[model samples]
Target: MTVLSQLVSLVFGGLVPGFLLGLLAFRVKSRWCPRCGESTLAMPPTERDR
Candidate 1:
């Protein structure tokens, strides 16, 4: 019973949160455009800026 409880805690407390945080970090770090390496958050420049 103790072993089973420890296994459950290790999986739920460690593995699950680690996986979720890794996924979030991957998404946040991977949102840049491949060609220009620019973030998608900015609006494209207008003709006036060209």
Candidate 2:
């Protein structure tokens, strides 16, 4: 029973959070345009800037 408890704690406390953070990082990185290496959500340049 003690070993089972420790295994559960290790999985839930460490692995779950680590997996979630990695997934979030991957999602955020995917938002960038690969060719230009710019964020896909970046605003278009206005006439004033041209």
Candidate 3:
């Protein structure tokens, strides 16, 4: 039981937060792209970040 609970906690703590952060990053990138007149598809989310 202890091991199972730890595994569950790891999944929620790591995977869930990473997924949510990625979603927020995507949203911010899209919102900022138009200001530079770059096509969102051409500019990678990581590249526009610079």
Clashing pairs in 3: none
Once fitted onto the true fold, the runs of candidate 3 whose alpha carbons sit more than 4 angstroms away are 32-50
Ranking by TM-score: 2, 1, 3
Q: Is candidate 1 or candidate 2 better by TM-score?
A: 2
Alpha carbon lDDT of each predicted model: 0.89, 0.93, 0.81
Please give each candidate's TM-score.
0.59, 0.64, 0.53
lDDT string for model 1 (1-50, tens) is: 99999999888898888999999998987888779988978788999999
Worst 10 residues of 1 by lDDT: 33-42
Candidate 3 TM-score over all chains jointly? 0.53
Q: Cα deviation of 12 in candidate 3 (Å)?
A: 1.2
- Once all C-alphas are superposed, what RMSD does model 1 give against the true structure? 2.6
Query: What is the alpha-carbon RMSD of candidate 2 to the true structure?
Result: 2.2
C-alpha root-mean-square deviation, each candidate:
2.6, 2.2, 9.8
